[model samples]
Target chain A: MQELKDEVKKLLEQGSIAGFLGMIATTSGVVPHLFVADKADEIEKLTTGDVRYSLVQILRWIAVRHPDDKFGIMCRACDERAMTEMFRNSQLSMDKVVMLGIPCTDELRIACECEEPTPKSLLFGQSTAKKWDKADVERIDAMETEERLDWWTEQLGKCIKCYGCRNSCPMCFCRVCTLNDDPLVKRGEIPSEFPSFHLTRAFHMAGRCVDCGLCEEACPMDIPIRTIYRKVRLVVGELTNFWTGESKGKSPLAELGDGTFPIQ
Target chain B: MADESGSPFEPKIVAFCCNWCTYAGADLAGGMRLKYEPNFVTVRVMCSARVSPHFIIRAFQEGADGVFIGGCHIGDCHYVKGNYITAKRVAIMKRLLEFLGIPKERLHLVWIAASEGDKYAREVDAFTEKVRAMGPSPLKQVRFWKDATVSKKIYKSEAAAETPAGA
Candidate 1:
């Protein structure tokens, strides 16, 4: 925590960054705050909080407001991944944003079953890369087709259509969400027409999700939305040998390609 | 056959056909007076890339036993490479179906050129029979999808059951 604060302070003092975005310890709790040069005291409050706030979402919000400003922000593996994917999509200019990578603790790695716990740009703390466990997807896949159908149907039945998952997702950057579109997802419906609603979201996350597990955390109904998306991440890997955030540029799904995937 | 209705179950298949190829091929099949299965309906779109994954998912939710996407051969799309994206999306969509425990076979992608009307007719018949063998979709018998309607119906039923004549 001290090292993080010192790094931010140095960047702020040098006028390299307009502000440093990170978690600030407060009476309420550790909340995401922007620390600038004038108010250097706030940098003292900067601490690596345990909670997984949508830091990328916050960065995008501020970046859009101040397009010309060069900003520094803290990032975990998922946050960094989301930012890179966002940069590739032209949502934010890469040169203007500097990342201070936060390494995930061993406990966090296990808890999130995080695919890649350490970000690309690490400045503080010792970090190690861990392989993602496919326990959830494998368990679900082990069941018979009918049994699996029942399991998912029950899971899908729990959705209240609160849109919590979409709201929490860092990759969900669409100005006009198709989930609310009339013809696609249908308006004024609850339990949201089963497989269609959930599958639509899963389809949209094809090459975008970095296995952040935020959607699963935000689901009020306790729906395992991550399993479907994790499956998507795996499929994207299998089909095109592409992993989100590992590289920059357009997702292969959007590109014109030679027909390699067999038509079944 | 032993059920009260006493009629064989018929599966419903929704096929999205690209206008530049598969749609025209279906037209050729029609012009040649070829007989195909009646279970599947072809929806015409300008390009197979236009068939969003949402359309397939919605078809399944609405009780379609099978969803088919018929696009032009690779490098032969009307818009030049539309089928490339269609192929990729369909492959990914299949994984999503399997992840949800739905049989991946329920969704299929096939390339049918404008000249291959006979092949289109043959593939449709095969797909229809395959879906029929799989029987009615599990999603077909869902009673209510609207939460508000279900809740209101529950309220009314409880009210009626509690006070027979509102006495």
Candidate 2:
């Protein structure tokens, strides 16, 4: 923790970054904060813990508003992947931002069912080798067609039309979201019409979703949204051999390629 | 066409066909009088890639039991690689639909050349039979406007009653 604060303070003092985006442990709880250079002394308030916030989303907001300013973020493995996907999607410029990667705690690793808990660069915390459990995805895959439909419908029925999943996603940077599109999603509905809202989002997330698990975390209804997206990722991988945020090139869906899907 | 019961389930399938390939194949099928299922209501686009995932979702939402996408064969796309994009989009869409409990078979993507009229007719027949067994889309059963209409009626009456008071 001391090393992280010192690094951030040094960057601030050196005028290397306009602001350092990290989590601050307040009395209310852990919240994301932008520690600026002027108040480098307050870097002591910065802390890395079990609580996860969408810091990359905050970085995008800050970067777009302050395009001229160079920013740094306290990023996790998922955050790094999210940033990579966002950069691939033209949402952020990698050259303008610096990533101060942090390894996730054991509690966070288990809770998130994270495939990779530590970022490429380990700046703070111990990097633990945590393997993700694919039992949930496999369980759904084993269900009968009708049973799977019933399970998803019942699960998605709890969606109060809250866009927390979209709002929390770091890769979701569209100016006008299709989830809010009246013609597509139909406004003024609680559940937003079954299968349409969720299915549309899953399809859109096909090659774009980084499997960050933020969308699932932000869902008030606990829809297991990440599972749906995992299936999407599998499809994208099977069809194009491309995983989101894994490649520097654009998604196959976004670009023309010689590769063909094995459609019988 | 109505069956013996006068209302046998006939799946309403929406087929998005590329103008350069599948659309011309359908025209040739028409010219040859090749028999194909009437379930397919075709929407011709310039290229298969033009049919976005939104269109497929919207088709199901608006009561399409299944969606069929047809494009030129690989390396034969009029736009060079438009069909490749279509293939990727459809593959992802199919996987997503399957995850959502909608059978992946509900969405079909095929490569049809302009000259393959018989193949187009056979593919449509096969897809129609497959979708017919799957039943109507679950989305079609959802009453999207039920609450909206009820609320609209209430608001209209309240506004009508307030007219005299306001004046």
Candidate 3:
């Protein structure tokens, strides 16, 4: 933990980055903070807690406002994947940012049900084993079509339309969201019109959702939103052989080319 | 559209057809007098890629029992590779629909040429029957229209009750 603080302090002293985005241990809990170069002493308060936030989204907010400045961010594997996806989408430029990758702890790894708990370039901590169980996906797949429909209706019926999932997702950077579009998601409708609201979101997450599980955590209703997105990821994989943020490559859905997606 | 007892269920379908291919094929079908279901409402676009996923979702939300997207063949797109993107979008949209428990068969993507008038008629007939079998969209069962009507009534009564007796 001290090593991380010292590393950021050195980067700050050398003027390598205008600001560093990381979590700070507050009296209540850990919260995201941007430590500027002049206030290097604040690095002491920085903490790597089990709690996760959309630091990549925060980076986007910072980058768009200050395009000329170089920024550094503490990234988990999912955060790195989100960054790569945003970069591929031309939402952010990798050249203007530095990633300080932090490996997830064992507790966090299990809690998140993560496959890859460590970033590609790890600056600190030990990498945990991958947990790729798809019991939730399999459980839904096993149900009859009618039963599945009823199940989803019941599950999605609990939605309060808070948009917490979208707000917390690092990959959802669209300025004008389709969720707010009056035609797609009707205005002032609680639970927001069955499958359209949820399915639209799931479809948009196709080649972009990096299995961050943040959406599920942020949901007030505890909807297994990530499971739905996991299925989407699988479908995208089967259809286009593209995994979200598996490589620093563009999304297959973003561009059109001959024979890239042969009609089956 | 009526049956023995009452009006039979005629499923509403939304078809998005590319101007260069499917729309022309549909026009040809009309010229040939090829009988097809009248339930389908066609929206013409320049390219298949113009039919965004939101359009399809909106169609379903607006009470469409099925959505039909027709584009030119992969190598024959008027806009070079418009159909290619369409294929990817449809594939993902179909999977998403299935995941959400909406029958995957409710959404259909077909390659139709301007010359294939008979094929266009046949495909429309088949899709209409499939949607008919699927019955009303699950969204309809939720009674969104009823909610809107009820809310409007409540607002009207509230306004009337608040009005001054002299006025």
Best by lDDT: 3
Tens digit per residue, CA lDDT, model 3, A1-264: 677788889888899899999999889999999999878778989987889999999989999999999998998888988888888988889888888888786668667777677788678777674677888888998888777776776667677889999999999998899889885677667745766788889988988899999999999987788899999998898887888888546677776655467654
Give each model a TM-score: 0.91, 0.88, 0.89
Q: Write the residue-wise lDDT of candidate 3 on B5-94 in tens digits.
A: 687888999999999999999999999999988988999999999998888987887778899999998889998888888888888888
Ranking by DockQ: 1, 2, 3
Highest TM-score against the true fold, candidate: 1
Q: Which ten residues in a row have the lowest lDDT in candidate 3 chain B?
A: B149-158
With a 3 Å backbone cut-off (N, CA, C), the pairs that clash in candidate 3 are none
- Scoring only the A-chain of each prediction against the true A-chain gives TM-scores of 0.94, 0.95, 0.95
Model 1 lDDT per residue over B38-103, tens place? 888779999999998888988888878899999999878889877878888888888888878788
Question: Rank order by lDDT, top first?
Answer: 3, 1, 2
lDDT of 1 at A201: 89
Model 2 - which docking category?
A: acceptable
DockQ of predictions, in order shown: 0.47, 0.33, 0.31
True contacts kept of each: 0.72, 0.65, 0.54
Which parts of model 1 are misplaced by more than 4 Å? Answer: A105-110, A127-131, A259-261, B1-4, B146-167
